[model samples]
Target: MKYIWFLPLSLLMLASCDDHLLGTTESAPCVRQPPLTYENFGLPMIEKNCAGCHSSLHAGIDRSNAPVGVDFDTWDGILLWADRIHVRTYEDLTMPPTGGLTEVELDDFDEWMRCEVFPNAERF
Candidate 1:
């Protein structure tokens, strides 16, 4: 009887020790954030997000060479319309018409607008 009780007690102690060794824990892979740049954020995002409806040969909304009413094909044109884009897409979330971009991508765009796109605005 003593040995039988000892075995059960030892098993319980071992289980408790195992639980302590494997305490609550979490692990997530580190995500390497891509560098924000014109090629990465500006060109690709615009091409994917806006070019379909705002490209050239589409009348007043073309975004290609002629850029319809708001040309974003050139650096100068992009600089000119940066504020409008920001307002429509970021502030109001009305552009794109399909789905909105992720907050990270939006932040990248906002940073780009503040740094490269709108700083050299002729009106500003």
Candidate 2:
């Protein structure tokens, strides 16, 4: 009968293993310390997460139907599509059809958008 306690303990451990179970939502505000820039943070992230389907080099079916002129290979493209990117990524959760980004990546994206993109866009 003492072994019955193991079931609830195991369930608790399993539940705690996933952040979603802890009631954390993707809408959580990002706090940037040193800050995230396009060169250091944004570019690399886009290369990894977005470029596969959103690069200009990918044409016809290779582009994965990412839409014409929706490339993110350049900072200029990113700046031009910033609002659409936000809506598609955060609000709609529809881009990056691969859904490969981790929690840390998402947080970095949030920080880059909030702290860098909107503030210094025109200057860039």
Which candidate ranks first by TM-score, i.e. highest? 2
List the pairs of residues colliding in candidate 2.
Answer: none
Q: In candidate 2, which residue ranges exceed 4 Å CA deviation?
A: 1-31, 122-124
Residue-level lDDT tens digits of model 1 in 5-124 = 888888888877622112113211222255455676788888788766665436642433333567565566666677678777766787766667898777666666555555455454
What is the Cα-based lDDT of residue 34 in candidate 2?
A: 63
How well does candidate 1 score on lDDT at residue 8? 83
Prediction RMSDs, each to the true structure? 18.5, 11.4
What lDDT is reached at residue 3 by model 2? Answer: 100
TM-score of candidate 1 versus the correct structure, residues matched by position: 0.57
Show how many residue pairs clash in every candidate, following the order shown: 7, 0
- TM-score per prediction, in order, is 0.57, 0.68
Instruction: For each candidate in the order shown, give its overall lDDT on alpha carbons.
Output: 0.61, 0.75
Query: Pick by lDDT: which candidate is best?
Result: 2
